[model samples]
Target: MLALYLLAGIAVCLYVYVLSLDGPESYYCRYDNQTHYNLARHFLDTSDWSALHTGSGAVADEAQTGYYPAAWHLLVALVASATGIDMPIVMNALNAMLSGVTYPLSSFVLMHALFPARRDALFFGAFTSVGFACLPWVLLLKGQLLANLLSFSLTPAAIALVIAYVHAGARRHWKGLALCSALSVGFFGVAHPNGLFTVLVFLAPFVIHRIADAITQSTWIGSRNPLRKPWVVWILGLAFAYLVWQAMLYAPPLQQVVLFNNTGNLNLSWAESAYAAAIISLYPEQPPQWALTLACAAGFVALVRQRRFWLGLPALYMLVVYGLCRCSDAPYTLRTFLAGFWYSDPYRVLCCAELFLIPIAALGLATIAAYAHRKIDRLSWKGSLALVAGVFALVNFFPFYQEPPEDQSSEVSGSHFVPTVGTAVGYMHYLMESGYDEGEEQVYSAEEQRFVRKVLEMIPGGALVINQPHDGSAFAYGLDGLNTYFRHIDTEGTTEQSRTIRDHLSDIATDSTVREAVRNSGAQYVLLLDQGLPYDEGRWLIQTGEDYEMGWEGLANLTDDTPGFETILADGDMRLYKITAEESAEDQ
Candidate 1:
């Protein structure tokens, strides 16, 4: 058992080492990352943590006043302040290490809490968790979702403490574990409310089983107060956790997100959602882990055959998650109502299922190893550990072991055709290719970031710059202390003046309405960017097409002799123009 633990620890460390390939400075940029980075910068600049606010655009904008979950932002701010290092480096390092270290250790802790005697299953399950690709790569790549990542990474540890409290069985053992469990649950809630929902879903089966066991024992003894059982301790612990969550919800920011955020709408039909859920949960990446999925099935069958029903709780949890994922859109069904609490997203629901599936997959692998050991004379426990370690190294780091490309310049983005998934090679490739090299999902390139700082120095503080969020000027507030017309991709709650400017800014020379809108929006400079990347062209147009189109036409219209505009800077794909027309149509 000790050797198994040591081997697992070694493998986990190696995984983190692999993730650190591009050093602490390199990060895959996304719009959300920019938004959160700006939030953290705001916190640092003001030293105010009362509520989340982005000091960009007009005061009436949602980006300026709307509330957001702030745990991830707060942590980044606190770390940067304490270390006095750059915020980007701190943000990237902490985000990576949190997922890299917490994930595997939390899986091991949860497996041990559930089955203390099954070392083989525990080892394989936790080992498998070290390679799980869905959350770290797919979900992270979606938006650089740091808050979601932090919440999910911590869920297993929180759930493990609750399970320990559930099985404590005595008054002396109860209070300490119960308090710990409550604190864990409290922390998980503030990290992300979706994670709190996940914890409750995962705990339902265990709580039910424990309550049933308490009832059966009470019946056998003919005891009174059967409701006053050991399971009630877990309930009290959860109640305290609830109190913690409720207290945080008292804050207006949390209230806005929890009570009135846009969530819970169904995106697919029942069967389609179920199929998508299964594919994302089990076969999340290319060359899907069919062997691991089959192993999970085999493990569940073995548990039922061996009459170890308690150990198969994760399978039941998966079933409940599947039902919720697929049935959330079915009108008149109970799930339709309950799905709101879980956010009604199949990806999130199935990600929770995938987390629980880790232990079952481990058990299946262990069962296979045991069978093979019996049949083959040479295989031993040491050999099993070695085999697991070898597999871990091969799948994660083997493909990217060769020499990197010759041109390691951060100015030009690189391209890789193969899937990076969760491998260390994948991590480096993502930073170099999609982010710095090609700017596919990236908001800004290395050169653009430098130019932004120089542009900030040129402009006065608090001056509003006309910008399209998709063109990367949305990052101005976070990366440098400059305001922009659109602070984020979402244009909800924007001022009427800003909206008019967005649609007709290019007609400022001839159109009276465009001139009036620009003057009213605080006549200032314009930040234009080259529409080169796939996203810049049209990939994410559903959300930012209007803004991109407006910016593209404005850039084309602003030549050297264009009326009411003077080009300030035209470096590569980025252009900064000074708005020369302060006179409105009425003034003219």
Candidate 2:
């Protein structure tokens, strides 16, 4: 059974690798992926991983520095070192393969732990591992995909530890369970912050159970308790491990990374929860095939019937899902479900819950199958054969039918670029092979492409540049150049300082003070996108018309009118202005 499961995992990995090879076009514009890739490449080229600085000289603020754990970055750097492969490709491939294998491996572990009976475990693993809800998203969005893989992988391990510690008759087993739980939780936290969220949710029950056990055992272990008592050892080991992991989070570098650029806000809304649920439940182009859908339904029923404890996982997941969904009342608005919880984006959380639910759903299906086999002797062979056939067909065809939706216009323009992993790679390859001139103003398909080429050209000889719209632009362009500095200036006015500066400049309408500030920033170049004039202007005007209009005046000093500022390049509606003190100081 294990060998069969391993083979299934291998097949899934191959399928995902092929998907990763598809193209550069993704549902989301590969903005975050590019950001991580660029940063990783910069780290590799410069061998500096301490500061959360990008090529655009934009340093991460206190809260946002450690948003991504170091593991993914390290992997990218290692691949760059060993094979000289592009960091994007390497990282994408790794994420894809892991995503492909994760569902099956996780399901196998989960089912086996929950159902010690071999037949039950195998049945649940096969059925759940093939579900539509689990497969499609994991195989698509890179960030969510990678996060789900890590979360699923760690979830089973953690659950196993909880089971062993709580149920094992021996002290040694209990100690081992505690150690394993510590490692799993620590690793999960390090992979993705969302994984940490999932781990916390899973740990609630275990923590409660453990606390009860500890209280019960306290009297027994007071003075002359047996050293080998299961509960005593389990409690001590868990306590030690938990403290150790907690300390790791507080380590100097990790703490700095976590707390960097911290912004406290409640950004959730009730509307987002409904929208997310709708997206999960209905938005895909095609519904799951009957077989898999039925199987999942069955597994869900089985899980509900098998153990009361299993119900907690799904109930907690739903509560989180609903809570996160309710973070916003308006559709697509960024909001939070609870106070003090930073916006990790609950859409991704929905993805994680879906992952956990798959195995339970699978168990439900297997339970139905088990019942059928036991109830009738002659029908057993027919039922078993039908179930096996259904599993095979479902796994093979459900992912095909349940295709990811096309990238919405908002996703294209917004920070999230939604594209399949394959499409992204293909787009990159196309750009590289086409040898497209960076100086030309030809329209490019992907927004990042034009910006990436422009930045690449400006810094061809290791020159420094500053990028505006720091979210994607800073990360994407900084990868190509050495001394890139991100002015940390958000044209959209994301921060108070930026908003105040924008407002003051607009009020003053080309104030000398603002120009001086821009000049003094030591930025050699500035990049801006011309989003079809009136609309872009209108949006900015709405955000800060007076300040925005004023800031534009300072830009003249750095652009066509200012002697110090010269248009070095313009491509696909993006304008790059270079700063020079010698030419502009006197004029200013």
The root-mean-square deviation over C-alpha atoms between each candidate and the true structure, in angstroms, is: 7.2, 8.9
Candidate 2 C-alpha RMSD relative to the actual structure = 8.9
- TM-score against native, each model: 0.75, 0.64
Question: For residues 383-426, could you state the per-residue lDDT of candidate 2 as single tens digits?
Answer: 76467547644443333321134454323433122323222222
lDDT of each residue in 1-588, candidate 1, tens digit only: 445544554454444433443545555556566667677777877787644343433332644454455677788778888888777677766665665666666777888887788877876765566544454444455555677778887788788888886777636678777688778666765567777767776776567667656665664654555445655645665566557545654556344334432233333456644554443333222333445556667778877887555556654555454555455455533442344444444455556777877777777777877776777788897686567546644664444422334453212332212232344434433433444333343455556667777888888877778876666666666656667666676666677766667666777878777787777668588886653344434334234554345434554455556677778987866788888765444467
Each model's lDDT: 0.61, 0.47
The C-alpha stretches of model 1 lying farther than 4 A from their native spots are: 1-31, 51-67, 219-285, 306-339, 388-443, 460-463, 503-523, 531-542, 546-559, 583-588
Q: Model 2 Cα displacement at 290 (Å)?
A: 6.3
Best by TM-score: 1
For candidate 1, report its TM-score.
Answer: 0.75
- Total clashing pairs for each candidate: 4, 69
